[model samples]
Target chain A: MKGRAEVRVMLKDTVSDPQGETLQRSLVSKGYDVSRVRAGKFLQLELTGYSREDIVARLEEICSDILSNPVIEDYEYDLEEVLE
Target chain B: MKGRAEVRVMLKDTVSDPQGETLQRSLVSKGYDVSRVRAGKFLQLELTGYSREDIVARLEEICSDILSNPVIEDYEYDLEEVLE
Candidate 1:
């Protein structure tokens, strides 16, 4: 079955997030009155020809191997069946 | 009250996502048997001194005004109370 998967990849706690820091700075510069801005990445995939279990397993691998850098990032995901 | 807010930002349909395309190519090259990779940005904020409703409204403004470019991107978010 065809399906959609959403993978959210984020910097691990020990990693330095320059991008997030820069964004926070910008927001503060604009006088938004906010703090503690952490940023990450989100990926949505259109996956095909796999059962739900297969898709989940494959996606988990893809997330760890390709979607994120293990030393610096972590990931989570959601999957749903989709119409072809 | 202190709370956490998650914001997901993505390119609009009309925008070209070179990063996503490049990632897709890299995944394909690695023989992942996958297709259609769309990527976006996610942000987690540690916000303070606001009611749930206030936080939601402020975050909506922050997302539209700073976190995303309306001409080319869109965003969504979830907010939850957190311990200080």
Candidate 2:
């Protein structure tokens, strides 16, 4: 059983993006005119066969509980089935 | 003169992804045991000042002549400079 998906975890707009800020600052220092950079996380996960609803619910639950914060983070996911 | 940027375009992976496979076969026929999904395209542009290496060399020459496609599509950009 193999499950695969791409998950994008991001801080809510209201939350500060320290990594993005640092990256932008670096670019700016290099004379890159960088202004804003919203940093977010992307992840790829593999799992076994499961109901999409169940997986999605679990994913969302994980996001709100640990992967991200309901208070300052949002997430998106893309699930793919590898039929070999 | 204002310039903003937050462009993330994808299509570089052998160039084939039908909207992440119809959104993982509509979440595996609404039961959700999706296996794989890879859809990529995100953009958020806001511009004010320029110079960040001349806007990343004209945004990599407009992502190799038109927002993306070096024969396989690989791009990542984030240039915010809205100091208004």
Model-by-model DockQ, in order:
0.67, 0.10
Give one digit per residue, the lDDT tens place, for model 2 in A1-84: 454766767778888877767756755665544456666654444445456666666666544664456788788877766566
Best by DockQ: 1
> Fraction of reference contacts reproduced per prediction?
0.68, 0.05
Q: What is the lDDT of candidate 1?
A: 0.83
The per-residue C-alpha lDDT of model 1 at residue A48 equals: 66
TM-score, chain A, per candidate? 0.91, 0.80
Q: Per-candidate RMSD vs. true structure?
A: 1.7, 8.9
True contacts kept of 1: 0.68
Interface RMSD of each: 1.7, 6.0
Candidate 2's displacement at residue A17, Å, is 2.0
Output the worst ten-in-a-row residue range by lDDT, candidate 2 chain B: B41-50
- In the range B15-82, model 2's lDDT, one tens digit per residue, is 77786677556556655454555566443434343466666676665546654567777778766554
Cand. 2 Cα-lDDT: 0.61
